[model samples]
Target: MATSVLVLGAGFGGMELATVLSDELDEAEVTLIDKGDSFVFGYSKLDVMFGREPAAAVKLPYAEFTKPGVTPLREEVTQIDPEAKRVVTDSGEHEGDHLVVALGADYDFDATPGLAEVDSEFYSVAGAEKMAAAIPEFSQGRAVIGVCGAPFKCPPAPSEAALLLNDDLISRGVRDDCEITFLMPLPSPVPPSPETSEALLAEFADRDIHFVPGARIA
Candidate 1:
């Protein structure tokens, strides 16, 4: 009998794992499942947030992917039985020889008191698009890029947003009018690498972007 592998949340990790397993092991049955029908790259979200690309242009449909021994299913995962190697989804339940769970982190806006009430959150696609639309109308004010919590995915995203916002304001000829501030709980922008952090600090200083270290946004 062929070995069956079940994978959840067809993100980058899930997709790559399924593809590699299917390609390498011909007799293996790979089932890749996700709640959404398509995949969107993280960088694409930044592009959309910065008004560099539209949302439609960044989505890659899973239906277009063709791989032997690999099956892609769009279903919401309701439960997971890790010991039994079984998964229950909205459509049905499935049992497999191996189960891989790669579902990424979920953002909780209510975790912060006033986060949901804020104008935008660039972490999500919808929020990014909304902020992108609002960016053009923002003529003069303090633009704060902050992380509500620590140990979030993509540590460099906040810094990237600050630099991009600076570029956008400069392009609009309103750079001087807008003050950009980036807040993080880390002692430095990139704590793992001191050289990289120094480079980032230099860039922030040159661009007149305020860097608030060891700070947390409420």
Candidate 2:
């Protein structure tokens, strides 16, 4: 019998795993499962928020994904048994010789009270669209780009949001009327690399974006 592999989550990790397995083992059976029918790039949320592309255009269907021995299954994974090497999804249960769990991080809005009541966020496709619509009406105010919690998805997103908002405000001729602040729990943006962190700090200074380090939203 061919080697059976179960790959959960259709994000970058899962997709790559399926592809590599298919390429290496001709007789392998690879099943890639994800709740979402289409995969949206993390950066694509920024694109939509900035009005660079519509939300409808950024969605890439898993059904269109093609690989030799890999099959994409659109289903929500509800349970996993590591000992048994089995996964139960909304559709059915799957058992494989090898199981890979690559489900990406999810937004935990409930962790902080009043977070879901906020006007907008750029973390998700729908949130980005809501922001794009709200931008035109935001002529003047203190725009705070912040991370609600540590270890959230996309470390650089707050920086990206700040810069993009600054550009947008400037383009609308209201930058001087607005104040943009970026808040994160990390000591500095991009903490792993000193050079990149310094560059980002310099950029923030140049753009007049106040960087509030060691600050976590609750």
Candidate 3:
């Protein structure tokens, strides 16, 4: 009998795992599930946020994941019954010999007060689109890009936002009239890599972006 596997989520880890399993177990049936209709990568997300890439370009369709032994299902998994070896979704219940949970990380904007209400280009795709649309309208003044909290999904995204915002200002011919500030709780712009840190610092200095290093926003 062929082994039945159910993989939840279509994120980075999940998608890779599913593909590998399908390749390894030629006779096995693998089902990939996620609540989201499409997959948007972390780096590609920034492009959409900056209005450099259209939303459609960033969305990876599930239909394109058709492999010999892999089945892609679009359904919201509501609950998991470990003992019973079954999963329940809006579509129906699925029984599996093996189950992998890979729902990915969710954004908690409400963790900090005033964040959910504030205009943030980093949180949601819709939020990014909204900010992108609003950017061209603002002719002058301060464009404060702030990130509150640590261990966020994408670490370099804030710095990228700062750089992109600076580029946007310059392109609009109002860079001199506007000030871009990066608010984060890091000692360096990029925490993991020293080279990235130095490069980011130099970029910040060159672009005249105010860096609030080690500063926590309350």
| TM-scores of all candidate predictions against the true structure | 0.97, 0.96, 0.94
Over 4 Å off, model 1:
none
Q: Which 10-residue window in model 2 sums to the lowest lDDT? A: 149-158
Give the top-scoring candidate (TM-score): 1
What residue pairs are clashing in model 3? none
Where does candidate 2 stray beyond 4 Å? none
lDDT of each residue in 1-218, candidate 3, tens digit only: 88998898988888999888978886869899988877777877668777788878888898888777888899999999988779999999998899999988787777878877776655677777787678778779998777677877777888888998898889989999998888888788879898998999998999999998887676
RMSD of each: 1.0, 1.2, 1.5
Per-residue lDDT tens digits for candidate 2, residues 1-218, read 89899999999899888888988886979999999989899999999998999998999998899988888998899999998999999988999999999998888888888889985888889999999898889998898888887787778778888888999999989999999988898899988788888999999999999999999987
Query: Which window of ten consecutive residues has the lowest lDDT sum in model 3?
Result: 116-125
Tens digits of per-residue lDDT for model 1, 44-147: 88899989999888889999877888899999999999999999999999989999999988988898998898859888788889988999998799988888
Instruction: Look at candidate 1 and tell me the lDDT of residue 129.
Output: 96
What RMSD does model 2 have? 1.2
Better of 2 and 3 by lDDT: 2
